[model samples]
Target: MNDEKEPQANPWMKSLLIWVGILLALVLFVSMFDSSSRQPDGTSIAYSEFLARVDEGTVKSAEIAGNVVSGKLTNDQSFKTYAPSDPQLVDRLTAKGVEFRAKPEEQASFWMILVYQSLPFLLILGIAFFVMRQMQKNAGSGAMGFGKSRAKMLTEKQGRVTFDDVAGIDEAREELEEIVQFLKDPSRFARLGGKIPKGALLVGSPGTGKTLLARAIAGEANVPFFTISGSDFVEMFVGVGASRVRDMFEQAKKNAPCIVFIDEIDAVGRHRGAGLGNGNDEREQTLNQLLVEMDGFDANEGIIIVAATNRPDVLDPALLRPGRFDRQVIVPKPDIEGREKILAVHMKKTPLAPDVNARVIARGTPGFSGADLANLVNEAALLAARKGKRLVAMSEFEEAKDKVMMGAERRSMIMTEDEKKATAYHEAGHALVSLYIPGCDPLHKVTIIPRGRALGVTWNLPDRDRYSMTMKQMKARLSLCFGGRIAEQLIYGADELNTGASNDIQQATDMARSMVMEYGMSEKLGWLRYRDNQDEVFLGHSVSRAQNMSEETARLIDSEVRRLVEEGEARAREVLTDNLDELHRLAGALLEYETLSGDESKRVIKGESIGRDDAAGRRAAQMDTAGSSIPKSRRPGGGWDAAPQGA
Candidate 1:
């Protein structure tokens, strides 16, 4: 019965048709009334008398009919008559005057009225049809757009970043070049039965230009590049993530031999079966679909997936297997030369003064990444602007570099005069100790003025890159870390030790603990590493179990660490005591200059006759204590003879 019922007409059209019909009916009714109201003589007459005269021949010249009469009058004039046709109307007309006239040709016919009324309906139907058709078209377009991959495609002309635009990643670039060549000529390698890698994973810490490298690949290959974030896949709805993965792959396949780069893949590719609760189930599903698409039945399709993640360990192992990601590129922190190149790249657009040196800036920033270098340049330019300088000078960059690494200099930080003096002497002690320690890098600068949260800072610039460290180097560093507190105890008694040495103490303690527990540099422990448990936590849940260790061994590890720190502290006190007068002189110089370089501090320690290299050699020979569990032999015959001692 429901199917048998015909659909109702559209309300919008029905109302339009009804209004048109009413207008036509009103026009016809008005025309009929006009035809009945007037006489041929242009004068009103009683309707009954007029009808009587029309019916009788006394008014013989007028012919009478239903509501109409026409005749030739006695005066030879054409005439017409009008009256009510019914008997009831005739009775009413006997008391009322009425007149009539012939209807004009301009009055429309019934057929014409019907045609005029239906015109509007036809016009409305056409307009409604056009609107509905347009809406359907737009709806289809919108749906198609939703399934399209959000990856940005960049052609050669559109991509401004190329291999030349990238810096500080020479090895990564060389590896990526193979992909670029494959994109340029796929058949060359295909003819030799060599299949291009399906994917390459870029793993590194944040701000290391993983995204920038992907762009360079696209620009170099001159192919369509698709870039999207890992988070783009997972949506609130179930199956949405998988659907997006399918859509993304479909898009990449359509643009065959293209690169599809996903940044921060860990967002979707977290290790399955690790996360607690059902919240991550959708993400896991998305990751599963991605794995299938990467290495399933259609694995060798021309699409090359490039993904980047800082936390590669958290990614699904399936995704990183041989057939899936295929290759993993580690973009670690830049080294000295890499840093210099990165600094140079960022400095190109900066308005640097003639004396500004990229090498100096690179040397100052030790652990900075490519993004950090860019930010450093921008910060230097800002400082220059603040000073109203025409160009960024070397001094501005120096200040900016310090601001980036150590934080902004707080010259206005308030402290008591006694506190200030104590800080100055403490920093001077650190400088003095580092100066006399062999294998310790030369001091870059020592400033008693407060910077960031630090009451004072002693900057040590390494003479060269040292990938490996010996026991002498570690012990020397420990002594330097303890020197500040040692100086306070010696000059102003143990009561003078303030919170200023908190960071130094913590660092010294950590080093001591690592030496005893991890590095096995303790005499009694003898090559035993106590640290076995190292579990990483994600989202407040432990990803793995901790290793078990006995309480007795833990106590022994603690004792060894404490012994190392105490011995280092005693040595610091002894060194500071012997150099007390020189320490005072160095502190006084620092108070005057607000900063003392490594060379100036060394001059205060040994005078002009003792060159930096000679002083370093002497210090190395003096620190060779027997029975001390120094990890490596400290001999002056090696490259230690070449480095400047203090600076």
Candidate 2:
């Protein structure tokens, strides 16, 4: 995708040319001095033939040096030959009236001798220089540029992203708009004697559009934007990182009113004293330099430093204090309305079918970040294109959402009839239990089709965005988690239960323990929290990972967790036992259809048909009106092999 041309002076090709030139010079030097093996451009003959030519009176002239002979015949032809050590050869040549002389050996000049003597040393030095230059380039600094900053200045021509491109984080966008305004008209704030914020720290989970927001700020202000990763500042050398930090601030001062964004700042800004290493550690030194640069004696008036980190808890306190990072912008995951806005932004570039609804998709995706929504839109588009459709449809969006939330369907995995039936019953139990539970989420889907690592999945969709859980909801969730195992135990006997409930058991245990210890829901625990502090032990803090409670307290906590899980299991077993016929009906529907939507599942539990025969009739009508070219199951939600659904 990079259209830029390669540099003309390719290092690989340059090294090859250097070696070739050296070899050519060496060959030329050796050829100049060695005259014994040198041959003249003439016909070759034996030594006796040269003498015979002289005797026959055909010799005009001859030359000899180091046992090599060259001569011209009277007929004006040239000849050369190698001669043995013969004492009479010179006398014979003289007696035959053939003019002959001993030619001197060629010798190299002073410059050539000097070059030849120093060739190896020169080659070694050249290789060393080339290696050093490559190393410097890899370090992102040229030779003697070890202290130079690696921040790249982003320009408008490099795919400019304005405020219009950023969505879902409206509050964050509004917060940063003032900074952009300050950059455009600094006099506005200056006249009021109010200084613009020196820095802003964007705190958020991953994929929350923090970096995108930074770029949008630069685009809106129309000022220079210098961006670099925090890791780029640190190097193996202790002082290199600090030197780079100083150099970066110096560049920012030159480009006043520009935004300097350091992404993943936690890399260099982790708490210094918490590490095992001494104060001279490279990362700690870099953090120290950054602290001074942000809020030091020298006022960096127009330079605004914007940094992003997911782990703000681990950052150095000095870096996050006021005057350094004046504003801490929280870029949380988008809610329903925010998700709709984000989807609308991404959908602008995509060709959508009339049925495609952004609000519905947003509502379906409860906790999707802006990036997740964008990927969802992209995945929907990909699915439509894969199906040879010109525009993305609602069904494609639904399928794409399922893929993003759960995982891709593994229809290629072979399953026996009994396995499929067991999985259907297992998923049916979850769906049925959720429907009957008082505070449980709405049953969105139940499927026997394998997705991700699960043999079957029962999905629940919240009617509204939930920020916290209530006690009733927690108890209902525990029962829902145990539903699958309980159903298996009842139908196939307790001893024959499969390992499909392993994840469910683990989740149930964690939630119950969290309730008893962290949430303080256990009446016997007397509202006291029993959770342990989790620290970064690898960073040399909190070396001991042992529990904070006594053995008796630990035993009590375990018993409480087990009691909650058992109560949940008992509740699920009671519900399933009472509605045994309904469970069978739902499981049978799942086995027949392979997947069911929320409404269809409700219908099946109520002892009603899901009207699949009517859908088949519609497909048959389509086949009759059109031709046999279209496959029966090619559409997203058509035919026998329909994709799984969510609320």
Q: Give the top-scoring candidate (lDDT).
A: 2
Q: List the residue pairs that clash in candidate 2.
A: none
- For all candidates, the clash counts are 5, 0
For candidate 2, what is the TM-score? 0.83
> Which candidate should be chosen as best, given TM-score against the real structure?
2
For each candidate, give its TM-score against the true structure.
0.71, 0.83
lDDT of 1: 0.72
Model 2 spans > 4 angstroms off? 1-38, 41-67, 71-79, 82-139, 533-547, 614-647
lDDT of 2 at 471: 87
* Tens digits of per-residue lDDT for model 1, 242-354: 87788888888898878899998999999888787474467888888899899998754778999999988788889999888999988877888999998888888888899
Error of 1 at 639 (Å): 39
Q: Which stretches in model 1 have alpha-carbon errors above 4 Å?
A: 1-149, 155-159, 278-280, 538-546, 606-647
- Give model 1's TM-score versus the native structure: 0.71
* Collision pairs in model 1: 37-99, 38-99, 38-100, 39-100, 442-647
